[model samples]
Target: MKAVASDSAIVLVVDDSPESLGMLNIALNNAGLMVLVALNGAQALSIIERITPDVVLLDGIMPEMDGFDTCRAIKQKLPNIPVIFMTGLTDSEYVIKGFEVGGVDYVTKPIVPDEVLARIRVHTQNAKLTQSAQAALDYAGQYVFCVSNDGALEWATPHVHELVDSLNGDAPCAWEQIQQLLAPWLAQGDQSQPLELTNFEPPLQAYFAGEHGSNHLLVRLVTPKKTKTAEALQQELPLTKREAQVLYWVSFGKTNWEVAQILDMSPRTVNKHLEQVFKKMGVDNRTAAAAISIRILESDEEAVG
Candidate 1:
C-alpha cells in the first residue's frame, strides 16, 4: 500500500454496510487518498453538494436510494467527476444500469485491493490529464502580445487584439500585418535568413525572418514562462515579431493545417511561414527547427532569486 499525499485525492466511498465501508477506507488510505464514507445515498448527497470529491466509489446495492440513483445524482452535480461502481451483484442489468447512470466502470465485490487501486489510479489520472489539457487550451485561447527583437510589433490569433491595442500605431493592420512589423528584426548578415529571438516572455522565445519574395514571411514564438520573473530574466533572442507567431504553433506540435486553423490563415500561408522559419533558424527541416527552438527557449530561462 502506497502512502497517499496529504493533498492526495478526496474519494467518496458510499456503501450501506460498515464492513464494506471499513474495507474500502483501508484500501483507499493505503493507496494515499483521503476517503469520505457514506452509509446511505442521502448522506452521500449531502457531502457531494458541499464539496466535490475527485472520484466516487459507489456500491450498487444500498437501502433507500440505491447506487444507480446515487450515481445519477453525482453525475448531475459534477459531470467531470468519475464514478466506479462496487457491488456483489454482477447481473448484466445492474452493470448496464451503472453505466447508464454515469458510472465509469463496475468492480465486482469482494473487492481486491489491487483492482480497487488500479481503478482509482485510472480515474484519477484521467481527471488530472483532462484538467491539465483544459488549462493549456484556455491559456492558448487568451490574447498574447510579444515585442520582436527588432522592436517591431507583430500579432497573431484575433484574440491578441485585446492585449495590444495597436498592430501598427499608424493604422489597423490585418493578417498581412506581418510584413510591416518585422522588417527591422530580419538578419542583417544573411539577407535571405532571419534572426532567432531566443528570449521573449520567461519561457517563451521567438524567431523572425526577413522579407521573402512574397509580401510576408512566416514567424514563430515559443514560451515556457511559469512566472513573471522567469519570463523577464531570460536574455532576448533576435527573432522578429512575425517569426514568433509561427514558432508558437511549432512548439505546440501543430501541423501547418492546425496552425492555419488557429491563425485563420490558409494552409498555403502557413507553409510559406514554415519555409521562412527553416531559413531563419538555419535548419533545413521542421524537426531541426523545433529542436533548436525548444533548446533555445528552455536554456534561456534565468535563475530567479
Candidate 2:
C-alpha cells in the first residue's frame, strides 16, 4: 500500500511485537492515518498522556502492565477516547475482561490490517461525534457532562472542572474522588434522585438528566442550593425541633403518613407534632400552618437576595 497524506486521524497501537507493530504501522500510515507505536503498556500510557490519540489499538497480553491494566489507567484519565483491543486470546473470558477494562471493540489476531483499519475508522468517527457533542454542551452554559455506566467521566464542561477543582483543592486524584462520589448515584441507573454533596458552605446538586446513549449517562449540575433545615424552620416559627421537622415536610404538601415516612416517626407521632405546631403558632389547621411556612420562606429568600 502507498502512503497517503491528508488532514486525518491518529491511531496509537500498543503491542510488544515488532512484527505486528511494523506491519500495522505501514498499513495505517499508507491509509492516510498517523500511527504511534508503543512497545509495551507503560510506553503507551506515556505516549497517551503526552498526546491523546483518536483511537487506541491495545494488545491484551503483555509483560508486567498488561493491556487491561493499561486500558484501565488510560480510561481513568481520559475516558472519551475509544479503546480497541487487538488480541490473540480469543477466549470468552479474555473478551469479557477487555470490555470490563473499558475496551470498546476487539480484533482477533493474527492481526488483520484491513479489519483493524475498518474498526479504527468507525471508532474515530464515533469519538469525533462525541467530542463535538461535548464541545456544544460546554458552550450550552448548563454545566452538563456525560459519564460511563461505571461513573467515569467521558466529558465534562469547564464549569464542572472548576467545581471539582474547588472542592478537591490540593487533593490527589480529585477527579477519581469525584467519580467515587457519583458511583452510588450512577449505580441507581435511571431511577436516581438529585445527589446532594455539601461543602462547608452550600451544597452541589447533581441531577441525573438521563442516559446519553446506551453506555453513557448525562448529569446536570445545579448551582449549590443551601439545604433548608429543621432548625431554620424552628427559627421561622416558634416551634420545637420535632414540630419543625413535621412542618418542614408538611409545607411541601406531605400528608401525616408521608411525613411519618420521611421523618421516620409513626403517623400518630407526626399528627401529635403537627397538633403541637398548630398550638404554638396559633394556627387551627394544616393550611394555616403551611401559609405561615410559605411566608417565612419568602421572607428568607428576600433576605438572601
Which candidate ranks first by lDDT, i.e. highest? Answer: 2
Clashing pairs in 2: none
TM-score of 1: 0.47
Q: Among all windows of ten consecutive residues in candidate 1, which has the lowest summed lDDT?
A: 227-236
Output the lDDT of residue 162, model 2.
Answer: 62
Which candidate number would show the highest TM-score if scored against the true structure? 1
C-alpha lDDT of residue 202 in model 2 = 34
lDDT of 1 by residue, 39-99 (tens): 9999998988776688899999888899999888888878878999998988899999999
Where model 2 places Cα greater than 4 Å from the true spot, the runs are 1-6, 142-305
Q: What lDDT score goes with residue 265 in model 2?
A: 86
Q: What tens digits encode model 2's per-residue C-alpha lDDT throughout 103-191?
A: 99999999888988899889988987876586656546656777877888887766666666676463347667657878987787554
Number of clashes recorded per candidate: 28, 0
- RMSD of each predicted structure: 22.2, 16.5
